[model samples]
Target chain A: MSSTLRSFGAIPAQRLVRTLLLAMMALLAACGQSSEQVDDMVDFSPPSEGVSSAEKQPPASTGNALQVDVGGALAAAPALPPAASLDEVAEAANRTEPEPLSITIPGLDLNQVPVIASGVTATGEMEVPSPLEVGWYRYGPTPGEPGSAVLAGHIASEGVDGAFRYLERLKPGDQLSVAFNDGSVTNFVVDEVVDYAKSALPFDELFARSGTSQLALITCGGDFDAQARSYEDNLVVVASVVA
Target chain B: MKKFVSVFLGALLSVAFFVVPSSAQSDDARIHLIHGIPGVNVDVIVDGNVVFENFAFKDTQDLSSFAGQTLAGLKVNAAGTDTTAIDAGDVALPASGNYTVFAHLDADGAPALAVFENDTSTVAAGNGRLVVRHAAAAPAVDVKANGAVAFTNLANGQEAAADLAVGTISAEVVPTGADDPVVIGPADLPITEGNSLIVYATGSLDDGLEVITESIADLGPNPTVVNTGDSPIDAGVPVGAGLALVATALIGAGMIRRSQGITVDA
Candidate 1:
């Protein structure tokens, strides 16, 4: 990561300024912006042929067909429509319009900004290794979808709490705002707060689509009991975009 | 004097465009840019079934394209939704043994796959090849004399190469509190190579009281909502204590994967 002196150290003054400007230009190359706060991912590009609202959703939960997830002890619940296939998702990303998204909740003093990438930081937060388990997906759909646009932050680094140290304080009815590059600011209100043992977590809940656009926020919570060197639970927050 | 300043500024502006040939590319895959903690984790699923959930960094696409200055002077609501940057990733692993890796590709042509058992009873290194066919398939991987290539020939999307270094990596010198994040000789085992390593915390993250207070005081253009006693409305705060209760049951099995091996050439 060293910026070595150019070969033409004694280049003309005019050329030196040119070089200076070029350095700035090289820096202009933004790796890529990620929408990681949410847990799920859609291609960066929009779907080529989007399904109409009518075709996009399942029939009312008339107790008919619900995508269900079951655990040894946990009960089954309706499932969500899986996002486009992997190929379609990637194609969407290729055509995706990555604009800077930022948000702030005045009542909560919450800042929903900074989408981190793997081994590539935004402002802060570290990169999860590659072929990452869930590489904490950074680019995802806007909230209100039955998907978990998951974003993982570090909690402990040598006896220290990382970015998501105090994620257990938010309550229902709180505000979660999103500001996109298009100048469109959208806010979501907390609707549900559910906790699951990572083993018993309702992966289905994150993607449970019910016609209502929902946003899912997940983080590691519970105690960091040093003895165990791991957290005891998971925090999941479901919210709906402020209509 | 005024003329001299104007000309100097003019010259500076003129040389800005072509003088600097970008030495690096900004195509990134789905991974963190900075190593925050000790390991990397990813849980890959297709349809509804879990294909792989790796907690450690193994074979993954590179996301080093995040080399740029933060956007500034955003006077207007940056509109029109034009793409400012893009990234691509493709990885290659060469070994006589069987190895399988998966990534989320956008479309059928965007992905490819092939079995490398080879044309004859024995697979030859240079003779074996696979292409990106579909999600049901593996990324198009080709074996070359010196190495291998895995990527789409379509010249679209953020295409990056995942280099798998095959060899005995030196034992890692993990952070033992006494060491300064780095150690001597084959330090940072399993994951060998000269590339930076990142670790993600398992619990929620906040600046804590003292850390948060300092962050606010030093709020430059880049504002980070680090936890502080003064900022009661911090976004990092968990929705409730219920999360702690749930974390207990999931931490062990929740660890998507244990150790994934990867090597990056410096």
Candidate 2:
């Protein structure tokens, strides 16, 4: 809606980058890799580079394995099942309905906002997110599934910046992390950013249930119309699995 | 021929595994049975089970729990009685397909059943598909959408289809010969995007013709097909035959070498 709202709420881009670089350096140091590798590991390129390089890397797994392995007194834990390959994990995702807990975006300085399943309204419009949380279309595929998983949040509400206030500034290669209810996290790299007229948004492409796995983040953007009390366009950020 | 048969069977088996039925808890087939026979109530039976009793004229029953494919015997009898009126024999019901069966009088005034297959193929973004079936005992008719003929001269037991932009449309049924005397509507019908809307015109003109509407939603475009496209011939000279030829050639060379007392590597 037309208002004097501006994104002074979100952290600055350079600040976010420096913080992320420091965090990646810490993680690399913990993993026995030199901090110098942080430059190559967390390189924030455009969406095309993210997609092509994602194809060359292994599935992103950033959990604290050492913490799990060295938690307590030295009693042997039960033997675990053979590890599954990336394809096997993706295939298995089809049979499971993993509930998402929160979403984190390092590039935008957006962290851990709760997510919940949502349905369309009686008037046939998708249910919008709360002022500070995101909503996932319940009828569509979930994240990690072999389809486009949609997440929508409010950019601004009631003349205040909402959770996705900085979503319009996200560039390709920005990393996004989603935590599931089961404590598992998935990493994705932004591939594309598009703004479509509100009347002509691509529903099929954003909600397809059979194709390459994708996560689409949507929010209102463009000039706000005072008469209509809504934005004229919708910003969509498309991302692919980091693996 | 033997190799081809094996290859074909292997392909079929592979497709069978890939087609594991949609695991969504609600992937069952949705079917609607419409009683269009004028003045006579009927009982709809499927697979020797009476599913709808005292099904009155112009009534529609939705069979929502029927799942998977099966050869189901469909018979319509006088309401609340076992006297057979129209026996549709066995019909196949496929999974995830939405269907409508209309029981109405044929052109000869005899009771008959016409099954309409609803196409649920996904339409382009912001579009929908509409299909009209002429199931009435009357002559050919025209189905108009927004005052224009979308289906022309569709006779009894025939159907026509058209793709339309997503929106509410005013549709009507008229005799093919003239645009006047609109029989059905100027009714506002909402055409949902990515869905198929089916309208069946049933009953005779003398008995008050009516329109029955059903919809099949969630028809998204299919995923890309994986094509190996290689035939058995591409396997190159059968393994057994090629191996035998090589063996024969090796034996001939061995014989020549042995006769000359030349040692040959095995």
- Per-model clash counts, in order, read 119, 0
Candidate 2 lDDT, A1-119, residue by residue in tens: 00101111133334434434554443332222223333433432223333343344433221122112211211122222322222342244245467776677766655556676765
Predicted candidate 1 versus true structure: per-residue lDDT over B144-243, tens digit per residue: 2122122223221122222224222232222222233222222211211221111111111121100000000000111111111111122343432322
Which docking category, incorrect, acceptable, medium or high, applies to candidate 1? incorrect
TM-score of each: 0.29, 0.43
For residues B11-38, could you state the per-residue lDDT of candidate 2 as single tens digits? 3322221112111113456656567665
RMSD of each: 27.9, 33.9
- Model-by-model lDDT, in order? 0.29, 0.58
Please give, for residues A167-233, the per-residue lDDT of candidate 1 as tens digits.
4556789776554444455567777777666555654445332344666655556555455555556
> What RMSD value applies to candidate 1?
27.9
